[model samples]
Target: MDAESQRVLEYLTEVEEGAEDVLATKQQIVDLDTKRNQNREALNALKTEMSDSGHPELRGYNLSPLSTEEIKAMNSILKR
Candidate 1:
């Protein structure tokens, strides 16, 4: 009702809005970072599976399932 009270209320509104914006930005950054880490882990797993050299007969069928040609191609990429 009073001018002083009105100014205080206006200032509080501005502060709350700014804080909400900062929190939203931080949440977005955290989400993006989590997604990036997950993708990096998935990529590393795929690379490991592709390059594992244990023969299927020796290691059983549960090992990396790449064929001889695929393994050769992966080796070429590593050499490069």
Candidate 2:
């Protein structure tokens, strides 16, 4: 084969490799964007539901209604 043809084939191979890399990067970006949107929608829905549930009027910690003394006792054990 001619030298010019060999150079052209090498250039084309390089171009193809670059294109494949760009496509893979684009796919990864698209996947990440999709996941972020889904997570945002889920968080917004949860916030709306919590608001509708009147969480503000519940009048206690969401975790437990335990007294401060009980919490201190648990913390002491956890420190060990």
Using Cα atoms with residue i matched to residue i, what is each candidate's TM-score against the true structure? 0.63, 0.67
Put down candidate 1 lDDT per residue, 1-80, tens digits, no spaces.
Answer: 99999999999999999999999999999999999999999999988987795555667556668999999999999999
Segments in model 2 whose C-alpha atoms lie over 4 Å from true places? 56-80
Model 2, CA-based lDDT: 0.94
For model 1, what is the C-alpha lDDT against the true structure?
0.93
Best by the lDDT measure: 2
Each prediction's Cα lDDT score? 0.93, 0.94
On residues 1-80, what C-alpha lDDT tens digit does candidate 2 reach at each position?
A: 99999999999999999999999999999999999999999999999998888857656755758799999999999999
| Pairs of residues at least 3 apart in sequence or in different chains that clash in candidate 2 | none
- Which stretches in model 1 have alpha-carbon errors above 4 Å? 53-80
Residue 10 lDDT in candidate 2: 99
Error of 2 at 11 (Å): 0.3
C-alpha lDDT of residue 18 in model 2: 100
In terms of TM-score, the best-performing candidate is 2
